[model samples]
Target: MTSSADAPRSGPVSAWAPLAIPAFRVLWFAQLGSNIGTWMQTVGAQWYLVDA
Candidate 1:
C-alpha cells in the first residue's frame, strides 16, 4: 500500500503557489518590509559606531 506522500507529483512543484493566496502574499510583503527596516537600522548603527 502506497501512501500519498510516496506518489510522484504530476508536474513540477509550483513556485508561485504562495502568491496565489492573498493572505500569504500579505504576510510575505510584511516580512519583506520588516527585514528591510531591520537591515537599514543595523547598517546605520554600525556606521555610527565606526565613525565615532
Candidate 2:
C-alpha cells in the first residue's frame, strides 16, 4: 500500500466548499457559526472536567 506521502493534494481537503454557493452562503454561514458556538461549549466542558 502507498504511504501517506503519496496522498493526492490536488483536490479539496474538505467537502464543505460546495455549500458555499451564493444561494447557500447565508445558510451555510449560519450553520457554521452555530457549530462553532457548540464547539466552544464542548471545550468549556472539557476544561472543567480536566480541572476537577
Candidate 3:
C-alpha cells in the first residue's frame, strides 16, 4: 500500500504557505537580517584576502 508520503510534492513555482504565528514572522525577519550581515562580512573578508 502507498503511504501519503508517496504523493507528489509541490514544485518550486507553487506559492509558499503562509506563516501564521507572530513569533515566527519576527524570528524569520531577524534571521534574514542576520544572514545578510553575515554575507556582507564574508564578501568583505574575501576581498581583503585577495588584496593582501
Q: Candidate 1's residue-wise lDDT over 1-52, tens digit each?
A: 9999799889777898779889999999999999999999999999999999
Off by over 4 Å in 2: 1-22
| Residue pairs of candidate 1 with colliding backbone atoms | none
lDDT of every model, 2 decimals: 0.94, 0.86, 0.82
Q: For this target, which candidate reaches the highest lDDT against the unseen true structure?
A: 1
lDDT of 3 by residue, 1-52 (tens): 8898797778664343445568887888899999999999999999999999
- Poorest lDDT segment (10 consecutive residues) of candidate 2: 11-20
User: Estimated TM-score per prediction?
Assistant: 0.76, 0.54, 0.61
- Comparing 1 and 3 on lDDT, the stronger one: 1
| Winner by TM-score | 1
Off by over 4 Å in 3: 1-17
Across 2-49, the per-residue lDDT of candidate 2 in tens digits comes to 988697778656777667577798888899999999999999999999
